[model samples]
Target: MTPVILTVFALTYLGMILGGLPFLKLDRTGVALLGAIALVATEAVSEQAALAAIHAPTLILLFSFMVVSAQLRLGGFYDWAARRLGALPVRPLVLLGALIAVAASLSAVFSNDIVCLAMAPVLADLCIARRLDPVPFLLALACAANLGSAATLIGNPQNMLIGETLHLSFPGYLAQAALPVVLGLLVTWGLIGLLTWGRWELPAGVPAPSVHSDERGPNTAGHPEPGRPLNRWQSAKGLVVAALLFAAFLFVPWPRDLMALAGAGLLLTSRRLHSRRMLGLVDWELLVLFMGLFIINGALQQTGLPAQAVAGLAAAGVDLQAPAPLFAASFLLSNLVSNVPAVMLLLPLASAHPQGATLLALSSTLAGNLFIVGSIANIIVVQAAERRGIRISWRRHARVGVPVTVATLGIAAVSLWLGVGAP
Candidate 1:
């Protein structure tokens, strides 16, 4: 029974690493959930143990932020930003810089995926109007979103997981991450600058687009009505909750997860939007994905994986003491399996240093820029570009991805070496 459960667990996570099972219809989420159910049926883990392994604190923090992001999305704030960015009267190069900075900055504070989802179409139309290639701009969106989310603990799912699991200091993590993040943005700008010049060139004296043309023209009958106007009052309420949540991170002497849950609860007391509707907007799929992975991984841990795999690494004189091997391992796994699941798989080994957790957070999150599939933000931008008759081929993305990943990871390594690891 133990071997059967361990094999299923390994296969499930291996499926995660492969992004899905071959010749099968299910995705990573389905694979993980099924793995957990398999453990229960095989009696390797009791229902109680399975439930315990699915840490509720992590789930609450994840769910609350999803609600927060959902509120911002429903409020039309992201849509407004998209249309406005589309209307900028700047050169393609300058526009690319602005797009990257804005996208990354917004992603640091909110959900990167949501930012891309709302901004992609607006950017697409804007590029079409300017006769400048949207491909570079869309790629900038992906790269910048990944770069920006690295700046904050609440910025992305993996960072949040690392924070809860490792008990990392929120402000300190930001300070440690600030330099790589800054250098990353600059490198991001440079890469986008080069790409725009060579691949996205438009003939000189082609006037920059006017704001009107980029606005997609006053509501055409064919286009769907703007997903309701930006709800200022609801938006304000959500913002207040967000501000309080951030304050909780800084000054409040409570678990960050509970504070976030409180803020989410505050938003739920509205008379207009149905609570169910608001909850429905939360990415329950992601939460389920996390829970399933946790149970699957927990079962693997019970199988003496450390003695089998980690001890062998030690036997080969490979040290996991500092961030060197761990960093390299995480960098590869993030690209191989995606960051969130990678973090879940590795967090068990990083429970030593107060900064170890933050290291796992930063390395996994930033390593995402290494390739197109390294992060969802990248895919979102590419898909959005495709929809607009633009194409951001993998080769085009790699030109930017390689340098950004190398530079950011270098900074992260040195930071860890010098004991500046998120203390």
Candidate 2:
């Protein structure tokens, strides 16, 4: 019974790596849920133990941050940034650098997917207005976001998972991730610049609406809502709350999730903006996805498989404490199961080695540059591209992705070696 239960568990997760089970209509989440049911049905784990394995702190932390991000979004924060960026007057290269920088910075704080989701169409429209091929610019958006989000624990779901599970210091993780993230963004821009060099033909004319599809009905800048015309009072309130939150992250001696949640709550107590409106902007699907993956990963842990896998790798001359296998494994596994799941799988093993968690976070994130499907930010750009009649196929994406991955990973490996400590 143990063998059969374990076999089913392995097969199910392997299917997760492929994004689905063979001959089964199941996505990664569905595959995970199925595995859990099988484990329960076969009595491999008791109901109580199964529940215990699933980490609730991580889930609560994830959901709370989503609320904070949601508050900003409903306030038209991202759309405002997009329009501001789009409205800028600068040379193409300057504009490109700014776009990458903005994407990275915003993604480093909020969910990268939401950052791209709100920004991609606006950027697409920006490209059309400039008569540039939307392909490379949108592609840059995805890669930049993935790279940027890797910079902070709050940036992407995976980083949060790694931080919570490993109990990494919020500021400490940032120290490990900051350099690679900054460098990665630069490399992303360079790669995009070269790839789109000849590709930028000015669109027919300087005319078209903005590309922000899911934005609020009226552009806050364009149409004043009778009285809510970008009040300094409200904006100041939000900024004050956010700034204090950042300071807390660096200096406050508390769990990051709780601090962030309190900040969100502070922002929620608005004089004008209703809580319901803010709540609507939250990415519930993503929060749900995190919860589901947590339970599923918990089930896998119950089987004692990760321990054995770690042992096997250790005995086989795989010193994860060393940079080589650690780097390679982080990169490969990130692409294998997507970065979030990959982080969950590896966070446990990361405990066995020095600086393991830091390397895991950096490598998993840089690995996102390997493929279009490698990160949620990538898909946002891809979907937005499809809407604009521009397609960035696997090959087209790989042209930049392959080189970007190699170059950035090389830089990350060296950086990790230096500041991440000795083996």
Candidate 3:
């Protein structure tokens, strides 16, 4: 049984690293799901044990936020915001800063992936219409979203997991994370702006309509193909609920999961925005992935091998409980297996350290800017740009991602050393 669990765990994480197995249609979600099923079927983990491994609170909070974000997407708030930013009569660099600020702020409160999904396409069109190069803006959007999400626990999936598992205070985590996130965004803007300074204009070879053209004016180009028009009432309702939930998270002694669930309930009962549309936008695949990873990881923990390995490492003078080593481990593991899985593997170590949760959350998230595949928000923005005939290759992404990641992680390390947001 131990051997079975180990094999399953190895193959599952390998799938994570490679993004899938050879000669299969499986993705990370599918791979994770199959691993959990394998564990249960082989009796490596019993049905009851498997069920117990699934963290209900984390899943509920994630689902609730997905609903809240869906409400905003369906209300056209994201599209409106993108177009408004694009239409600003500011200098190109100032516009870049604005885009970064907006992307980061929204991602801190909403799902960063969803924010990218909603804004990227419209932004691409706007850039093309204005004869501005879209690549830098797209990259900034991805980087900002990732960096900003680090500021709040509910910003990304992994942060939510860390906060719920560790029972970290929302405000406390915010204080710890705020400096790194803000400075990271600033670094992203500066690095991207520097790299693309004189080249902000679209190349002559790239085909795009002129800003003065009647057929593809800035206003028309920035507006995404008519989806849901902005519903002030629905958007306002979602915002109010989200605000109240945020307040409760800060002030009340209630369970964060239930508070979030209640907020989602309010959004789902809307009259104009059908529940089907709102629910349809939810990332059910992500929910399943979290559940599968939970079960598989739970099985691995039962095998006691991970504990033994940690003990061996500690004995060798590489203590992961210390802030510096933990930060390094979090960054490497996050890029290696992606942030959520990395956090899942590291949470046990974090449980013993006073600042484990903060270090893990910041390092894992800030590390995501290292590559295109390091975070889903990056993928979302890249894919969205590709659909609009704007290619952002791996080499292109790494040029910005590498520096942004290094600078942000440095800021985080310094903040942690200074005992900011220390629990």
Candidate 4:
């Protein structure tokens, strides 16, 4: 049973690192699902145990927020925001700053991936229309979303998990994280601006209208075209609900999952937006991925191998309970296995330390900017841009992502050192 559990754990994470098993149609989500299924089928863990392993608060909170994000997307608020921001008559640098501000703020409350998904296409169109290069703006969108999401626990999925599992004070974590996130966003804008100072215009040879698509709407040559116009009533309703939920998370003693679920239920009951449409926008694949990883990770913990491994590492002077090693490990493993899974693997060690939750949230979220695969928000932005014939290659992304990551991580390390004292 030990060997079987170890093998399943190894294979599941290997799938995460490789993005999937070779010669199989399985993606990371599929691989994770299979590992959980194998555990139950072999009776290594009972069905009841497997079911109990899942953390319902995290999943419920995530699902509720997804519903809230879907409401905003369906209401066209994201698209409208992008267009409105881009339409400003400011200089290129001013426009860039505005885009980052809006992207980061929205992502802090809403899911970063969904924000990127809804905004990418509209931003591409805006850039093309303004005759400004779309690449820098797109990179800023992805990078800012990842950075801003670090400000609060609800900003991204991994943060949400850490917050729920550890029961960290939402306001306390925000104070710890606020400086790093804000500084990071500023550094991102500066780097992108420096790299793209004179190169802000679109290449002379590319056709302008090629950037338009039916999903967003048509565009004439070099003219601002509308995509999804603002649904004022629906947008207002979603904003009010989101504002109330944010208040509940901050001050109220109500369970976050219940508060979020209640907010989602209110949004779902809208007569204007169909339930099917709202539900369709939900990322069910991501939910399944979380469930699968929870079971696989839970099963592995039962075998006590993780405990032994940690003891072994500590014996060798590689103490994960200390903040520094945990921070480094979080950053590296986050880029390797992706943030959510990496957080699950490290959460136990982190939860035991004084400021581990802050370390986990900051390191994992910031690491996403290292590469395209490091975060779902990055992938969402890249894919959305690709569909519009605006290519953001790996080399192109790394040019900005690498520096931004280094600078932000440096800020985080210094802040954490001062706040928690050295380990």
- Model 2 lDDT per residue over 89-203, tens place: 8866777889899999888877688789877876787677667666777777787888888888877887888888888887887877788778878988888887777657754
> Candidate 4 — worst ten consecutive residues by lDDT sum?
211-220
Writing each residue's lDDT as its tens digit, candidate 3 over 296-346 gives 999889888888988899999998887788889999989999999999999
Per residue, candidate 1 scores C-alpha lDDT tens digits across 1-423 of 678877887788688777778888878888888888888888888898898888888889888888887777666677667666767887677777888889988888777877887677767766666676666777778778887888888888898888887777888888888777877788778866865666575445544433333334334466532233466877778777888788779776689999998888877877887788788878777888998888877777777865478778878988663567778778888998899888887887787555677678778988888888899888887886665455678887898888878877787777767766344
Q: After superposition, how far is residue 75 of candidate 2 from its true place, in Å?
A: 1.2
Candidate 3 runs further than 4 Å off: 208-228
lDDT of 4 at 423: 31
lDDT per residue for candidate 4 within 1-423, as digits (tens), equals: 888888999999999999999999999999999999999999988999999999999999999999999888878899889988989999999999999999999999997898998898888877888998888999999999999999998999999999999988878888899888888888899999998889998987655544444455434465446566678888888899999999888899878988999999999997789999999988898899999999999989998889999999999999998999999999999999999999999999997777888998999999999999999988988887777677889999999999999999999988998893223
In order of listing, the candidates' clash counts read 0, 3, 0, 0
lDDT of 4 at 298: 95
Reference-based TM-score of each model:
0.90, 0.88, 0.95, 0.96
> Candidate 2, 193: how far from true, in Å?
1.3
Best by TM-score: 4
User: Looking at candidate 2, what is the lDDT of residue 172?
Assistant: 81
For lDDT, the strongest prediction is 4
RMSD of 4: 2.4
